[model samples]
Target chain A: MKILIADDSRVMRQIVIRTLRQAGYDDHDIVEAEDGAEALAKVGSESPDLILSDWNMPNMTGIECLEALRAQGSSVPFGFVTSEGSAEMREKAANAGALFLIAKPFTEDTFKEHLDGVIA
Target chain B: MSTTDTGQRRRGSDSRPVITDLMDEDTILAVAGDAWISLVGEDEVLVPIPGEMPGDVLSSWVDVVGPWTGSVVLTTGRATAEALSRALLRESAPEVLDDEDVEDAFGEIANVVGGSIKAALPGPSGLSLPQVGHSPLVRNPADVCRVEVLWRGEPLTISVQGALPPLPVTH
Candidate 1:
């Protein structure tokens, strides 16, 4: 499976990639996008199996990208890897069709717990 | 009332709880401690003690706009910021660090810390992208909740300062 990680901060993108490896999901191919607009563009070109995106980003937000994808009739599995995990954001993400949210300061275990069933 | 015309009915400042009313120093410290363990390292722990800041320092922060608007700022010496960037990058860290690398890494720390702090606040707030530079000035001293901690024996400060000036004192 291929995973596309979108975050404006390069440091955060690298950390997500690192945590994925630490979670033992190292076999999948990885793609990176700097912001939500790039993420939206990549969805067309990359056709990733999974998308892990940050909530607050330049250009487009993760939720906006998700809505756009659904509007375009794309059903790619989406999740958020963001700093905030408030009930409101989670509800917003889920209503927009997010699979799950992994808050920041996450651990390998957190990734594994969220990805096991999702990732083949 | 805040959005109404004439600006006659100002939102009573008393109704909007300040940072101290919502959170205290210990809570901020706990949040920062968790971030340190995750990003900096597992064994790394922040010492809850105040230290005199050095003359030259750098700050990274993210603004929280909502019921209680403020910025979650992290300030430390330039050297310490570089050290943190290296630690965050670990094996991927370049030997020679550039200004951009420090800003990106250090700013991310603020992002995470700020995000967590936002969640702890009252609600439905918007967080701005992380910024790296001199800290935003404290607009309302009473609205600020500051915590000083030592990371790796270096002084660091996490300040949750209000973005707006104190509401007009109703006589």
Candidate 2:
């Protein structure tokens, strides 16, 4: 499976990729996008199996990209890996068709808990 | 209604809750502690004891905009910030660290801590991208909640300070 990780911070992108390996999901192909707009563009071009995106970004936000994807009649599985994880944000993500949200400062176990079923 | 009563209503309308009203030092410490364990290391713990900050310091922060507008800032000695960056990068750390590496890694720490802080506050708030440099000035003394802690024997401060000045008193 292919995974698209979208975040403006390159360090965070590296962390997410490293955490994926730590969680034992090292076999899949990984794609990178700097912001939500890039993620949106890559979604059309790369056709990733799943997307893990940061909520806030320059140019466009993850939520905006998700909304746009739904409006375009796309059903790609999407999730958020962000610093903001309030109940309201979680509900907003859910209502927008996100699979799940993994809050930042996450451990390998946290990644495994969320990705075990989704990865396969 | 009396004229004085009308003025009271206006003051009430302008009243905004400060950082202490929403969250306290303990909560900020807890948030920072959890972030440290996850990002720094499992065994790494932040001691709550305060220490004097060195003259040479670096700060990283993210602005939170909502009912409670402020920035979640982390300030520490430059060496400590570099140490933190190295710990975060682990094997990925270049033999010689660059300014960009420290800024990116340190900014991310603020991002995580600020994100967690935002969640604890009232809903629908926006989080800004993290920045690294001098700390932002505290707009209102009463609008701040700061916690000082020690990580690896180095002093670090986490300050949640308001972006706006205190509401004018309608006396």
TM-score (0 to 1) for chain A, all models? 0.98, 0.98
A101 Cα displacement, candidate 1 (Å): 0.6
Off by over 4 Å in 2: B1-12
Q: What tens-digit string does per-residue lDDT give for candidate 2 at B37-146?
A: 88888899999999999999999999999898989999999999999999988888899999999999999999999999998998578889999999999989999999
TM-score of each: 0.94, 0.93
- Candidate 1 chain A, run of 10 with poorest lDDT: A8-17
Q: Tens digit of lDDT per residue, candidate 1, span B1-171?
A: 244366565666537778999999988988898888888888999998889889999999999999998899999999999999999989889989999999999999999999999999988899999999999999888999999999889999999999888878753
Give the range of the ten consecutive residues with the poorest summed lDDT in model 2 chain B: B1-10
Pairs of residues at least 3 apart in sequence or in different chains that clash in candidate 2:
none
Clashes per prediction?
0, 0
Error of 1 at B91 (Å): 0.6
